[model samples]
Target: MDPLTLGSIVAIVTVGVLFSGISVAAGLLVVSGGFLIVFEGFSALSLMPEIFFGKLNNFALLSIPMFIIMGAAIASTRAGADLYEALERWLTRVPGGLVVSNLGACALFSAMSGSSPATCAAIGKMGIPEMRKRGYPDAVAAGSIAAGGTLGILIPPSVTMIVYGIATETSIGRLFLAGVVPGLMLVGLFMLWSLYSTWKSGDANVLRATTYSWRERFEILPRVIPFIAIILGVLYAMYGGIATPSETAAVGALLCLVIAMVIYKLWSPTKIWEVLRDSTKESVMILFIIGAAGVFSYMLSSLFITQSIAEWIGSLDVNRWVLMAMVNLFLLVAGFFLPPVAVILMAAPILLPIIITAGFDPIWFAVVLTINMEIGLISPPVGLNLYVINGIAPDIKLKTILVGSLPYVACMVVAIILLCLFPGLALWLPDMVMGPEL
Candidate 1:
């Protein structure tokens, strides 16, 4: 068979296996192992152990767990609630501010945790019920949290960015910087939609009457500001060349644990244990996928599938913008079935060369690719954020969550278009901090 034909078959079979509801890591290992044995015989399988283990060897891998620990520690405590409440107190006077507060909280918490589900669950628990209690529509409340959770991957200290950096040999710190402006841009778009939803629902009068005294607003700042500072400090350390990604993550994790214990009284052994246990579980899951992806990558290379496909795409006579559109479509479809980290691990290396060859900045494309992945989080079939929102508000109906998140998905698409047109939205901060990519 031609490499292209065999590659198409492999893609179909792999997607089929994943869509069968099997574990992603297991599905990848099974598909890659079967293919290698079929084409290259059992002798070729010997490389599997080294390839899998080798994925974990990078110094950057340490940041994954440490960042997870930072997220897990805050998620396991009342920090999410406090963060939500803080935003709510300040935004009470503005029409539709409650839902807007949820988005704000999600963006901030995403920077802290860098986990989409964690951001959804943590903020949704407090924000959704409160928004509903204050007469926000179920779709509006649930959708806000679900959509906002996607910011987890687009914001700084993002695990998805970390994975993308490692996969494409891009700098993790610069990737983190690249995400900042685009992340804020998405938040701004979400907030606008949220306010529009409020006005459209005729709830502006009710929200207008709601007010918090200066005292109430100021009180919560101390609790929330420290966490925000931690996030900023981590960003500064990495961007200023003060620390490597792993070192920054380690310090940020420790600070988060300390703050959680001090402010939320999360000092009990059980609480601490839960934090550690959850972080370990999530980190190991990501690491396993990376290992499996390494083997999967090797299989494609051995069979000449990667080169053949890249060559086919390169030989196309399409404009660069058309090529980008096609690539975005492919990433979007892949994202529906695979989580962001898995998609990045499996696809970024293959796409990076194509993107650079087409005269696009890899750093800028990282933000665009991430925004595409964000849509998948709220989309159907395997939209994890949708499920998380449903879990938090079971009575809201998954369909409502999906409906509410659609506008936010549109916002993401718009962000991608803007990135394509401007490019600077994702590249400016990174360039300012680290100088332009060579």
Candidate 2:
């Protein structure tokens, strides 16, 4: 078959399989399987072990499982509740205070938890019900958690950053630092939007909840101090040249577990075992997808498809900003259908070189790409965050979550635009902290 026909077939089958409800790993595995056979005949079956291990045999990727365990440890504890209640004490006087507090909790939890869904699950269980009970609108309550949860992937220790760094061969530390400013900017934007929506609609009534005294505020601090330390310790370890990302992840996980078991008294043997098992299962699933994408990328390389597309993009005479916009647009749409990791894996090989050639800093592009990924987390039709919140509060209609998320989604778009305009937001922190990437 001609290249166009063959390419079309691969595209159709891959997307069809994914939309059919199979996991992303399964979808990529099928695609890679087909291309491997199509290109190399039956003898190619011998390469499975090499492909799988080769893709996963990276030092940096080791952080993924460690971070997963750390997040799971926190999730399996009272950290989520503590974080929310602590933030609520301070934020409860603001308009739509619960929503704002939920966003604050999600942000702090994002610092602890690198995965978006985990952030959502941990925060949603507490935030949604409390806000709903206090007379917050279903759409706003659910939407806030779903949108706020996206911060997990934008903050440091982000699993998405690890995958993106590995895929693009960027520095994971730099990627982590690059996310800090933009992540905070997005947080502010979300909070501002929350305040505006609540004030405009008079739902800011959450301020009516009993305001905490200074004593009460200080009392809640103990429950939150450990998590604060976890966030600061990991950031310092990575940014202050104390450890590699993998080492930092390992230390973070171990410390979090110690606190959970000894200090918080939240983790039992069964809970520890469950956390380990769940982390291992998730890590394996992600690794399989990574391996399959490696194979699929190789096939694209062999077919000259990626090179041809890159050359075609480079040939365009338009200004580079237009092309960057198009790339962001593509990512925004694709992220709705594909998980952030899958989108990063599939696009990195194709997009990174072009982005570099266009004179955009890879670090800035990574943050921008991540923001697009964040937007997808709360989007309609297939937003995983929406589904997660729905699972926690089954009475809240999915449509409510989806609608409520639209305002926060708009805030995220503003964030993406602001990042585009001021690449400094993404780059300055890395430059200041690490003295710029070579």
Question: What are the per-residue Cα lDDT tens digits for candidate 2 across 1-438?
Answer: 555556667778888989999988777877777786887786776776687679888988889999999998888888889899998889877778888899999998988988789889989989898998888889889999999999999898899999988988889999998889989998999899888877887743555776689999999898789878988999898888899999999999999988888767865678889989999999998888888888878777766678777888899998999999899999999988888999999999899999999999999999889889988888866789989999999988999899999988888889888888888988898898889667
Over 4 Å off, model 1: 204-208
lDDT of each: 0.91, 0.87
Worst 10 residues of 2 by lDDT: 202-211
Off by over 4 Å in 2: 1-5
> Which residue pairs collide, candidate 2?
none
In candidate 1, list every pair of residues with a backbone clash. none
How far does residue 272 in candidate 1 sit from its true spot (Å)?
A: 0.8
Report the number of clashing residue pairs per model. 0, 0
Question: Which candidate leads in TM-score?
Answer: 1
